[model samples]
Each structure stands twice: as C-alpha cells, then as structure tokens.
Target: MLQSFMNVFTTLGDTVVVPIVIFIVALCLRVKARTALMSGLLVGVGLTGFGWIINAFTPVVTKIVRQMVSTTGINLPVVDTGWQTSALVSFHSTVGITFFIVGLILEIVLFLIGYTKVFFATNLWMNWGFMIWGTLAYFVTKNFWLSLGLSIFMMLYVLLTAEVQADRYSSYYKINNGTVGAAHNMENVVPAIILDPLWNLLHFDRVHLTPDALKEKLGILGEPTFIGGVLGIIIGILGNIRRLGTLDAWGQILGFGVKLAAVMTIFPLVAHLFGQAFKPLTDEITERYSKGDTKGLSEEENIKSKKRWFLAVDDGLGYGEPATIISGTILIPIVILLAFILPGNKTLPVVDLVSIPFMVESIIAVTHGNILKTIANAIVWFSLGLYMCSYIAPIYTHAVAQYGVALPAGAVLIASFNVMCRPLNGLIFLAWISGNPLWIGLTIIVYAAFQVFLRTRRQQIWMYLKKMSDRNIAPTSNSNMASEIKKQMIKS
Candidate 1:
C-alpha cells in the first residue's frame, strides 16, 4: 500500500509523514512547552537517524557477516543476504517489532485507566503471567546480546517509566501499594518466559531457574516478594506520572523513547552474546533427565526436571507450537488429499479455512494479556463470525465437489466445527488466564461440547488422559474440576 503511495507522490513523502505526525502529537499532548519541543525533536531525529543508518549500514553488516561466515567455513541460516534483507530485518527487529510488542503491552495499561486496583487486581496478575511467559520465550530465542542491551535499556526504562506511570496513576488518586505489590501469576507467565533466556544470560544466570521452574516457583513474576514489590512500585510510579499534570506527559513520553532506543540498541548485542546459550542450557537440562531425575528428586535434579517441563510446554505451546502440530498432523494431509483427489483446480482447502482459528488461538495464547489480548481476541471472533455467521455449507460442499475427494459434507462440517470451536476455546482460556467470569462462560460452552463428544465416542478423551505419564495429579485434577463444573451446568 505504501509502495503505491510512494509512486503517486513521486517523492519520499510517506517517510516524511510519520515523524511529523509523531512530533505533532507529542507537542500537542505535552503539558510543558519545553519538554514538548525536546520530545518532538528527539522523535524526529531518532526515527530519521534510525531509518538512514539502517539503510546505509545494513548492507555493510550483512556483507561482513556473510564474508565472515564464508571465511570460517560456516553456514548461517540467513534469508537471502542483501541490503534489503538486512534493512528489513533490522527495521523489523528493532523498530517495527519493538513498537508493536510494546504497544500491545501498553494497551493493557489502558485497561487500568479509569478502574480501581481491586477491580483489575486479578486481571493484572493474568496480564503479568502472560507477559512474563511471552517475554521469556522471546528472549530465549532472541539474541542474548540484544537482550543484554534490552535489559540495560529496560532496567532504565522500567525505572523511568515506573516513575512516570506512578505519577500518572497518582494524579487520578491511584495509590501506590508500596514496593511490594502483586505476586507473579499465569497471565504474565508467557512474557516472563519469553524474556527468561535473555535475562538469565544477561545477568549471568542470576535468575537461574528455567522458565517453567520460574513459573512454578514464582507463578506470576518469577521473582522474590521483594522483586514483585519493586516491580509494582515501578509500574505504579509509571502509572502515576499521568497525575503530574499534562506538562509532564512529554517528559514521560521522552523517557519512554529513551528506554525504547536503549532496547533497540541493546537487543542485537544481547542476541549476539547468547546465541549459543540455548545449546548449553539444552545439554545441561537433558543430562539431568538422562540421570533419571524424577519428581521429588534432589534440588538441582528437581530444578532441572521443572525446567524441562517449563521449557517443553512453553516452547511447544508458545509461538503457536500446538497449532503447528495440529496443522501438520491434521490439516496438511487433508489439503494434500483434496489436491490430489478433487477434480477441478483445487478450491480453497477446507482444512485451510478451519485451521485459521487454531492458529489464531495459538498466537493469542502466547501474547501477554492486556488490551492487546482483548483486541486480538475480538479480531479472532470477527473472523469466526464471518465464517459461521452464514450458512457457508455450500461453500464447503462446492469446494469438496470440485475436488474428487470422497470426504463427506458431514466430515467437512465436522472439520469446520473443530476449527470454529477452537476460537471459543480461546475465549475460555482468556477467562481462565484473566481469572474472570469470561473464562467461566467459555468453560461452560467447552464442557457442554465435550460432553456431547463423549456421549458419541464415550471414552476417547478419558482414555487419552489415562495414557499419559509423569502427570501432576493435583493441578490436573483442579483443571478437570473446573471443566466438570462448567460441564454439569451446560451439558450437551
């Protein structure tokens, strides 16, 4: 779309607009004149400089990397090596990705905007758990050097933003619950996990606990009571900055920018540093398993065992891993079958249509809960609404007929049912993660459906559960209890 505009403008006009808009927004919203101007200037300079430096330097970096690889007889899984690739990766990783990620996270704060602490207290933990897990996973795969840079940048950012947020929230009569605040929970677990590898490596293993261990040890923040208190204070402070009147908005925003820049600069460095840490972590972790460290093992062994579970679940379910598995196992073969058996030019794969929701849930499940989760979930519903809102049975039937496939319309419908229901499952998950009524409603729907399925097959799900090994009965039972309570009320 922008490409078309570039041709129409016959100049670099598109590039010209963002900075100008950013500056103007900063200037207008800023309470203080001096801070506004400075913020405006910084935004303009920083963004422009970033674009230019990336354009000029990316090629050099790529060439140097490529040459280094060739000389050392190394082969890196680089997507086509060119200036464009380098620039794209740089822009995406540093600016685009960071802004989007932070923006998504920031949206959660908006949920707190006119609400009291008591109302959002539970929601906050859910949000934290999701962020922690997502951030930890991101860091694990992300460059350690990049994370180091991000950590230093984030530490400062957290501190500064904490002050600003505290001040902002305070303006609205929000009280800081001192340094000690909420404990880490499942909501932010994903972010914590995403940030874990990078943070662990950056701090020289200060948070030695694996992402899973951390989650189990520190369900929400994965830190001590002191750390949670400190974090809450920081967030409280950042939230409070809005209380300082409009004049401070510019400074607060500027501070945030500095923090973001620090992240941009440092993440690449962190990525470079911990590029190989994943290997050693894997090795040490695997060695423990081979040593037969089961539950109730020695501390190190138990720790390793816990780490393994966290790593497995986080990685497997994180990053749409579950959906990928499902698609590979179920969708792909369906698509292939249709392609080969169907008569006419292959119509859209039925599996393709159905797979969309599974993928959506996978992504949403991993994203830190906040306004982002709400917005993303809304989008998912919109998509499902489009598909199921109408009797699109003909669409499915026609597609199937066009192909010579023998799959019945009923089978296609079932497949569609599976996919459509998947998104609703996401809603239950959302409620569960949020620890709210939303989860309860969705759980009812899921349990009802499960009961219907059980009546037909009678024993598949139970049989499947029974076949599993190395289980955590208490937690599993609790989850099942939640499901059963939901089931009894709305049995299908």
Candidate 2:
C-alpha cells in the first residue's frame, strides 16, 4: 500500500507537482480560484519550457565532452553519469520514500518555527538531496535509523542555508513579488559560504564586473552569446583537432558555436517566462497582505513598507543570467583541461557539463553578477568537485553494485561531480572512510554554529540599519527591503 501510494505520488513529476502546490498555496492565501489556477498552470508551462531547454542542451554537451575524451585519450576509470543517473539511483533506493516523508515533515517544522520561510514542499523532486545523504549513510553504517537521522539533519542544514541566503539573492536580482530563490545544488552553498569571508577580506566585494562592464570593456566580444559561441568554438576545435584536419575542425567549431550561442540566447527568455508565471500569484499575495496601506509612498518606499511573505521558486530562473551562462560556458573546456592536469582527478566531468549554470548560480548571485569573480570562485569550487569526485568514486561504485545497478561493459566504476561535490556528502564520505561517527557529529555542530552566527550577524546589521532609518537617513531600496524582510522573518 505504501509503495503504491509513493509511486502514484511521484508519477505526477515536478511539472504537475509544482503547479498543484502553487495553486493550493495561492488559494490558501485568498487568491481567486481562476487566477490561482491560471498562475499555477503558467508556472508549470514556464518550468516545462525551462526543462525543454535544458534537455536540448544536455545531449549536445554530452556529445561534445565525449568527443573531447575520445580525442584526448584521457580515460579515467570511473564513468561520469552525472546527476541524472545519481538522482535515479538515489530515488530507487528502498529508503528513498522514507527520506522524502521525513524531509517534508522537517521542512514544515522549520517553516512553522520561523527557521525558514521557503517551503521546500513546492520542489518535491529535489528530495534527492535528502535521499543522497540517506542512501550514503545507510551504505556506510548498514543502519536505517542512523541514515534517517542524517538525512533529516542534512535537510535542516539546506533549509537554514536557503533561509539565510534567499533574501540577498531576491533583492540583488530585483525578483519582485516576494519570490525567494531555493537551490537544490546545496554543494554550491558550501563554497559560497567558505569563500565569502575570503572575498570580503580581499575587498573583492567592492569590484563589480557586470554585463554592462563587459560591454563597455570589450563591446560585442563581451556579449554573453558571443562569449558562449567563442568558447564553444574553441572547445570544438580542441576536441576535434587530433582527429580531424584544421578545416574540418573549424567546420565543427562553427556548427557547435552556433548551437551554443542559440542555447545561451534562448536561456534568458525561458527564464523570464518562469519568473512571469509566478508573478501573478506573488503579486496577488503581496497585494492582499499589504491591503493598499502604503499607496501614497514612493515606488521604492512601497517596497520597504510591505510586509514579508515568501513564494518559493527554483533557483534555475537566475541561472539564465548573462554572467552565469557565459561563466559556465567558459568553464566547460577548463574543466576538461583540469581533469587531465589536476592530480588524483580520476573522474572526467561529462553529463554535468550542462549543469554548470546551476552549479555556479549562487556564486554568480553572491558576486553580484560579476563574471570575473564568479569564474574565479567557480574554478576553485570545480577543483574541489574534481577532488571530491575522485575521493568518492570507489564508494559510489560499491554502493551502485550493492544496489544491483547494472554497469556498462568494462565500466567497473562511476562517479559524478553533482553527487560528490556537495560539502555535506564529502563530510559523510569522510566519516564513513574514517570509521568514526565523530566527524559527522562535528559537521552537524559546525553547521548549527554557522546558522546561529548568520542569524545573529543579520540581526546586528539590521539593527544598525534601523538606527540609520530612525535618524531619517534613507537606505538603498534593496537594503531597506532586506532589512524589512529580515525583521519579518525574525518576528514570524
């Protein structure tokens, strides 16, 4: 009975599940039924469009990477099946349903307690985050209860990170209508958090390298589509140079470049559709909550005067930003180069090549859309991903074999950047390898301490801003909204 229900529940997929949740939430918030339903369906349509774009690009990227590997003759033992395969393996686990249920309960508890405002129930498919931890934990300890606890703890960690970071992203991106960015690529969060202080210490935060800056510096060459095209052409040439003559290589390069340019060009349009789909529901909810109480205020002032409410959406909407796409495009060949040069890097990144935008989304956000800073940070993070993927490949292979997953002929091992790159997963793998539970315990402790520190630091900053506001010194609109949102989050 339980298995049947689980199957039925998951059968709808995110295309259906996300919209249904949005509709239900909108109705609960007193949005009219027709408006809510339309908003929900549009959101689904937008998401489906985004998915189609992703699907279209993935095969192209995979073919490119495979060609590069075949040309270079750099064969690593572990096959890189990427996140899709890893997610499938994770979701098929017997413990998968249990993790999803527990994660849902924990998400609700966190939201109700004001620990987080972004309800992850809306992104049900992302429960693979919890499943990864649970499946790995069970593999290590062969104990169900321990795995369950660890999965719950991992979910809590992700929620807290999202809670702390969401407002900053929304405010910076000017994503109006109370929408909060929720990322399933929690691995990116670790590097973002770790590097943030370093970035500040170096005063790199003062540097802004936005698309406008790029345009001013390099004209058409700096445009995202041009950058993507150039990079794609370079990759294609490099991939085929050993196998094809110069003219043939150039032909492949031009063809691939055009395709890549098209993908980058279409990304932002699809992303806008995604953002638009949520706008009506969010606008309605925000309006209903505000009750036209601040109609006389300035446009900026109205944003400040509004109370805090959150509408959850996937972080992918921002992945289409120019800086992110360009940076990610540039990183594809760089990752391939690093695989050969970086010591102990056994896994060659293939399928996850297209996922670079999502992987670097948070970094791009925190860097304030600075392409240079995002690329610098991504290089470091991708280096870590390579090392971590190498470290976990053996265990990953063992777990897959243990679960009776079939492998390709002569492929005894598999690993993925998407699975092993997560800081939480790295920590779990370390604990298992060391045969000491203390490492995992310490990770939890450090995570909890960091969350507390973030909360306290936010409060202190807001308190200072509030003092300025009281003195009639106006803060910037984004800062003002951030302050207001923080206060509301705390009060809730």
* Model 1's TM-score against the true structure: 0.23
- How many angstroms is residue 280 displaced in model 1 relative to the true structure, after the best TM-score fit? 45
**For residues 359-379, what per-residue lDDT tens digits would candidate 1 score against the true structure?**
332222222111123232333
Model 2 scores worst on lDDT over the 10 consecutive residues at 465-474
Poorest 10 consecutive residues by lDDT, candidate 1: 176-185
Say which candidate scores most in TM-score. 2
Alpha-carbon shift of residue 119 in model 1 (angstroms):
22
Give lDDT for model 2.
Answer: 0.70
Put down candidate 2 lDDT per residue, 162-206, tens digits, no spaces: 655555455555566333333345556556656766765675555
Q: TM-score for all predictions? A: 0.23, 0.85
